[model samples]
Target: MTSPYRVLRSDREDPTVLRRELRRRTFPNPGLAERVRAILQRVETKGDQALVELTAELDRIALTPSELCRTEAPEPPAAPVRKTLRWSLGNVRRFARASRPRDWRMRNREGAWVGERFLPLDRIGVYVPGGTAPLISTAIMTIPFAREAGVREIVAVSPPPIHPVLYYALRIAGATEVYAVGGAQAVAALAYGTESIRPVDKIFGPGNAYVVEAKRQLFGLVAIDLLPGPSEVAVVADEGARAEFVAADLLAQAEHGSSSRILLLTPSAKMLEMVLSRIEEEIETLPRRSMVESVLRDNALFVLTRSLEEALDLVGEFAPEHLSLAVRHPRSAAKRVRHCGAIYLGDYSAVAAGDFLAGPSHTLPTGGSARAFDGLRMDHFFHRTSLVEYTRSAIARVEPKIALFAEIEGLAAHGRSASVRVAGRGRHKENGPFLRGRPPSAKVR
Candidate 1:
């Protein structure tokens, strides 16, 4: 029988081919972009009407403009769900609170006080994907941090047939408003605003390709958390790692979607064989077997490397969203990982821990974006404004130098403005506009 997953040997496969294979994971789709653009345009032009129409068409759930905004709060979740959500929220909040940066001021050598003032955004929009799954954990990961940052308005949007559990989770996580909307249309509404839903300052959370494309296109219009694509993971294991644990980690990431990428890099071929066998067996028992198989067919890989060093090099090149170090001295191995968005150390530390119970937000940068972007955090909700203060003495000390510098830059009025400030007067006839030019009478001479 054919192997369930492709096996690439570093000693045999060309490095260029390896890179090309990885690049396929992030290949651009014009069709997806065009579709997302249309949705965005429709929502931008038609407002709430477009949202209603698109939600019904795409999600197969009829909704009117009035129904866009959920009117009543959902009842509290059952004990088990509430308990888990509350626990997750507490962990996220505690971590966020501890990690949040503080506003600080320091006097410079010239006696000017300079500092950054961190202020919470007035409002933000959080997208919870209810299509394939409700993603209640997304609510816990996103909203609580906004709340901890003191965001005043937390607007939550998700597609129809939204699980009751999601509603309760949002409420528990401090969502001030909830709406029945999803996909690119929902992102557009949050970005541009509608008759009912006021535009938010920034939008957070993750979604499918359309949603990621929407965020990428609408980034400048409204502040965005990050352009996160499909979910992915890379596991760097060794002979010491358990095949079952490694197989489970790979399967966990694989079930995310067909577009998801899963990789296993190890020095031991035995470890690789064991993981592959375990995956084939365990995948048969999973509810999302088709999804796991779809990803495993093309996107997933089991790489055999000559050494651990080569495995780490492959990891840096991949720059996956979640990385698992299932080897002896996992912590030391983890230290070599410089690019992954999140690292799961040791066989005991499952990616699921970071996904659900871990304090850190599970919404991470994907599709090689982990090289530059960080996982969602509390600071994402706050805007930093720099504060500067200079006394008259401080201004006087630098005025002549400022004038000279402005003169050299050919801005006569810039020099004049500084000179006038030193003179303690407003703009006089001698000083023209901000640009360098002749005085009122000197022109035409």
Candidate 2:
């Protein structure tokens, strides 16, 4: 027997490993704030010249204005990928349309009319980071939401892609413009407009540690969608859970990046043994095996809990980016969760589906931000403003009480202002020429 193919269980816990994960979570990159702030100040002061110089220094993609400012993404795709172009574009359009609002209105107790109105930002910048591989979904996930928000102009910045899929995604998602700038410098250009690139009201999309830090620094000058940390997922599984499904779910999140944290909590030690075997067997056939291997060996964990109840408690504590209920009753298990950006019910719906076509926004709050925040939705795009109308009678009815309260607070002008309307226009100027403050009746009445 060549050693039970994947039952390698380690009851041995590493103190060093626990310390490393804890440190990564609480303390972000030191010196990032000062560095990004300095970069933003330089960009704001220098404008397009700064952008051009930064592109050369940071992105390694030197560009003149003509080369960098793309009115539209490049041409479509090759013959094979061309077939899928319309379908992909249509899917993006459909999601965009579905996420937009109808209208809203309401009447107040004063018979004064009031309602909420949603308006879109005039310009938006979308950052799509690519140092290693181009993320086509970066455009897909972000642009649709911006369009749905009714943003008239969408400028997308990426580290210049040689790949066709990224250009294709930008084209399909309907970004109005594209730029070749990359990293924190790109973020600065978007904040304080250059001669070529315009400042945007808000910025959306995700990136590496540097890009994220830039967004954090620029948040006050412009609205940022969310502070994205590393990608993470937690799978809560129980007895009779498919080992293949559990292993696959765990590996999928692990492949996101080396820093992504993936976890599998199960009540059964036997099931844990089964999943480890299944993961080894499946890894050989995977396209991204090396990345998955790093995740499996370093970033992922399989924990043995006292019971299913304890497993749920742990998942709640983690509040990961993506969560899966791989237990017997997935629906029931999902209900037990108090926090998570998105919840996958049962084994059939892998995290991939939610990432791509599912109606909900895939731009989730990560790194336990889910404890207080929520995933991206239409609400993230638009804010509400109240409308109010008060008639003469509405003012007259509340006048007496308003005047008395105003006088009580020593704001005599406030008391008379309310009383003037009801006290007759002639006496208004002289009504207060009585007692030091005038009796309460002379005020409100």
Candidate 3:
């Protein structure tokens, strides 16, 4: 059988070819985009009827409009599982509360009171992928942030056969409602709303290609967190890094699915060889062995770089969803990285920590989107509105500048709006033209 991973030596390969190999295209290839577009349009036109049809056809689960929303309570999880969920929820809640944005007021250059107030979104939908696994932790990672942000309504949706543990976690995380629908249809229902399900102001969480594409297509109609589709991890290892630890992290992400992207960039060829050997040995132990193997065979890359710096440069170009720096000075190495959804430093800092127990939400930008987008955070749940208050004196001071701008733009009414306020100031108002409802001079010039 052919080796699962392909290796490239930077010293031997052409730079142009290496660059082309590292670049990943954004999600929803043309065909996927068209399909997602049709799903969205179907939902928009047919509403609940489309949801039932799509859920039955795609998810293979039959549901009535009423069954779409899960109202009955889920069975409690085992004691050990419940304890773990509570512990994780506590950590996520504390982190979200501490990191949430604060309202502030300050004086501007013109002495006007200007600041921003952060308000929680009225309602939001969190999509938890219920594919091969339950993804129990996604609830803790996503919903509590919205809860801590004070969002009034937090709706959660997962595929049918919703895992009991997942449903319990969503409730503990403060989800106001739970739905049993999934896929592009779930996203469309959340975005456009069905007869049974109301639309939310913003949508959160991550999922498969269809879920991400649905978010992309419905962006203007509803707010979306980010295009956090498949999982991705790039590990930059040095000679000092442990081979077993490096290999374990790579395999951990590979189990996410075949679409996951995994890269191992190392300066030490010996380290590379050891990790490859270790991966082969560990692959046999995982229950999801075939899934991991598929990812390793098609999506994994092992690059031998000239130096650790070169490897870091390659990581920036890749802009992986998860970055692991297993080097002598991982902290220092992390300083040079420009793009990546999240960075895990040192051999001991496993990406799984960030994925499951770590306070940071695992819903991160994937497919090279880290260049522009950030991982999910508490602040994403808030709507920031700028607060501006101008005193009479402050408006008077800036009136001339406003008039100049209006005159330059030929917006006479724009200047008059501001000028009228200043014009009315200090006037005994009974007969003042500014107060008599007369229009201000048409020409500010």
Candidate 4:
């Protein structure tokens, strides 16, 4: 059960060594901007008709808005639903209803009552990925957040892996309009305001490399939640940790794609061995054995450390999307964790628990974004602005000081303005208390 990447020295701290051990680029694709821009232009020129033609040519789904927008569609959870797209439009409605917000106001230190005013974006387009698989949860996680934020006129666009049953989910999720489109073009339709669709102020949700690239390129032109990257997980396990739990977690991330990476850090040689054996044994019977193997070969790393402290140090450096602490006292280990999108504590609470049913947001920072970012929450949908007010007496009290500071900066006009308010007359600029209103060349007695 010994891991192939065990470190003999637990306390080794050479700067170069640490860098080499943990260094990796979670985002590497390039040239996505040019590609996405081209597609956005095409969609803008063609409109709704363009979107239909693109759907048929790129995804093999011939769809019209009437066909794609529906309250309910067929159900093909793990299999093809045939002819029409299969989705749960009602579920989208449920999520939207659950996400609405309440008005808020407050009194500030200045005593002038201030509050925020909330309004919905004029229009928004939903991006549903239907290429490799149908993503019902994607609708739940993303569209609901927008709906809760009071976004109006939400539309949807996606390419059907088969036909176009998936659009039904968009309708259910509070989408007023829907389109059968996918890839960069879908992003384009949302960004550039194609004849069929209006350009939006922002774009949301995660997608493939091409889609992610499009988002990145258009960041300045439009707002985005966060950049999507390869899936990643890091497991911190103690001697008592279960090998089955550790192996299953690695496999779950592995199934994301060949690019996805998983890491295991443990203080127990015996535990590491058990996990390795379990991984090898389970892969043969895995539903996606080929994917598991390919991921392990391309981006996997298994580390055996001398103690839990060393494991903790390495885990923080990676800042994985999902982190599971399977130690004797999982809570104790969690206190040391400074970085991780989500943490699954204890053997009973595995990564899978947080993936689906956990009340916390599943959309989290990936790559090394955990270093400065947090998982998506209701706050992500809101923006903050400050209100400040000062009394006229307050200005009078500080005018003398303000005048002196302005004179020091050689802004004669600024000092005049500062005193002008104090005088309540023409040119109410404050006289410099330090200079007693004398010119710099004039003597102060």
Candidate 5:
């Protein structure tokens, strides 16, 4: 029987065929966008009342204002749970602390102390998905980085009937507030604010398409971690790579949702067939077999490449959120890949490790956005400002250049402003405006 997934040959088929197979599929839905926009406007206008109504209508859960805030925290997670979370937290925090940029100062050509100062945002909101899974790892991946960056406040939002494990993770990760809400409405509340939920400077984490769309619409209104549309993975394997390992990685990504995509590019036709067979056999054992099968049927692919270079080229074209190099020399093979959001080297380095226990946040760019965006990092929480300090001698040294620049730009008054500061004449004693308080006859050319 033919495999349920698409199998394309790069050597024998038209390049367009392979291109078509790799191109991301878009669901045309202006109605969904309009509806999300309306929901945002309603929450913005009606405040807490809109959140209460929308939670019942959309989430199928009822919540009052006080209940929405999750007034009291649950007891600390069980000993084992705490042990596991603390372990992961150490990895995430250590990596984040190492990656976080520091404020730096350097002297310029004019001897001015000019440099960049990094300051953490005042507040941030983290959205952890509740459907299908509680994603307790998301709390560890997102919140600790903000805390490590010294952010003033970190708020978390998830759909109601909060999972005990998720609550514990959020608390341990140092989330200042936890809200029981989800979907576009939750994003709207975080971006626009409501009576009970104060607005935040930025939002982080992943959700369904609606959540992604809401983040897209409210981008300028509030900062977002990245356009994490859906979970996706691309793997480049060689003949020596294990078929079961490749198939398991693909299936794990496919189970994320129907919209998720998985690509397997290799020159090994025999390995391709073996992985397909392994997938067919292994899928039946999974509880989410139907969901995995749907993704496999619609979005999964096993492409046959002419060479390793060809396979690596396709990896760059897809710009997958996660790229696994299952070849014999993963480190060397990874050098050719240019646009993956995260890279998992060797067969033993599973994407799940990066998603859960690895030192980096799994909140990464998706839907081909990895070409330009990066996985979420601690650097994302800070805003940078340039610091410029000039002494009187420094200002005097650059005054001619500054005046000439302003004059060339056709601003005579600007030129005078700079010259007057050094000229120290009349009312321009402290280098005030060059045009102000100048007598008609005393006007210098």
Candidate 6:
């Protein structure tokens, strides 16, 4: 019988062909993009009506504008579940606080007061995936960062029939408003506000292809977090690594959905065989066995490398969202991987830990986007503005350089704008070049 997953051997296959197979398509399907474009256009033009119609058509759940924003709060989960959620929220909050950017000022060589100030967006939206899974962890992973950043209004949206646990998580994570909407329509409503839902300054969280495409289409209309779509994991394990642990991690990611990508890179053929066997045994026990099986058969790949180093090199090419280093000296091996969204070191460090309980936000770039984008962070909720204040003396010092640049760029007004401040104006004791005492004409010109 043929194996469920395709196996590529470095000794047998061409490296270029293997790499081509490993590389994920960076662009969305044109057909998918067109469909998402229609949804976005509908939402942009029709507002709440489009949202209601699309929600019914796509999600198969009818909703009215009045029912879009859920008014009543959901009862908290059971004690044990609530305790676990609190534990996870606490870790996420601490991480957000610790990782938040700080405002700082420093004098440049010309002694200009230059710095950056980060301010939280006044309002933002968080999209939680409610299909296949409630994704309660998504709320904890996304919203606390905005709350910790001091965002005043946090809007959370999920599909209809939102799970009680997920609703509870969203409220606990600091969403001021909750909406019963999902898919591209929810993203469109977030980007282009409806009658009830006001537009957010930025949007966060992850979703399926339609949602990711919607974010991509609406990027300039509203600030967007990185494109974190689907789930992906690449495990690099050696003969010394536990096959059970490696197989479990692969299956865990596969359980996310059929679109999820799973990869196993091993130098030892015996290790590869063992992991495949373990996956077959373990997958039978999973409740989402069909989904996991579909991912394993279609989206999974097993690569046999000449060495662990070769496997690591392939990992860089793949740029997986989550990387597991299940090998001897996992930490040292992790140091060599530069492109993955997140890394789990050692056999005991399951990717599920990072997905659910880990302090870091699991809203990470997917579909090879890890090559360019980073996982969502607390700072993503804040907008950064560069602060520049140049004194008359500082302006004088840089005027010649500015004049030269203006001359090169053929913008005489640009040079004059700088030179006018220093050229014959009386030296004032004010801190900035343009101050309250400056004439309106001087300030304008």
Query: What's model 5's lDDT at 82?
Result: 87
TM agreement with the true structure for every prediction: 0.91, 0.83, 0.93, 0.77, 0.92, 0.94
CA lDDT scores, all candidates in order: 0.86, 0.74, 0.89, 0.68, 0.87, 0.89
Per-residue lDDT of model 1, residues 139-230, tens digit only: 99899999999999999999886788988888888999999999999999999999989999999999988888899899989999987778
| Tens-digit per-residue lDDT, 1-445, candidate 5 | 2676788889878897777657554453698899989988999999889999999998788788888998586778679888989999999999999999876655567665565768999999999999668999999999999999999899999988889889989988989999999989999999999888999999998988788889989999888887688799999999999899999999999988888888999998898899999999999999899999999998887888998889998888899999999998988889998888999999899999998989899999888878888989888999888866665666778999988998799988887776776777444223322222332222222
Best of the two (3, 5) by lDDT: 3
Better structure of 2 and 6 per TM-score: 6
- Residue 247 error for model 6, in Å? 0.5
Residue 115's lDDT within candidate 1 is: 65
Q: Which ten residues in a row have the lowest lDDT in candidate 6?
A: 436-445
Give the best candidate by TM-score.
6
Better of 1 and 2 by lDDT: 1
lDDT of 3 by residue, 1-445 (tens): 1355898899999988898778776746899989999998999899999989998899888988888888887788999999988988888888898899977665667766666778999999999988669899999999999999999999999999898889899888899999998999899999999898899999998888888888988899999899887898999999999999999999999998888989999999999999999999999999999999999989999999999999999899999999999999988999999999999999899999988877888888888889899999988999999877777777889999999999999999999989998878564323222112333333222
User: The CA-based lDDT of model 1 is what?
Assistant: 0.86
Q: lDDT for model 4, on a 0 to 1 scale?
A: 0.68
- Clashing residue pairs in candidate 2, if any? none
Off by over 4 Å in 3: 1-4, 426-445
The RMSD (Cα, Å) of candidate 5 is: 6.9
Q: Report the number of clashing residue pairs per model.
A: 0, 0, 0, 22, 1, 0
**lDDT score at residue 173, model 1, on the 0-100 scale:** 89
Provide the lDDT at 166 for model 2: 78
Model 3 quality (TM-score): 0.93
Sort the predicted structures by TM-score, highest score first. Answer: 6, 3, 5, 1, 2, 4
Ranked by TM-score, the better of candidates 2 and 5 is: 5
Ten contiguous residues minimizing lDDT sum, candidate 4: 435-444
Candidate 6 Cα errors over 4 Å, as ranges:
430-445
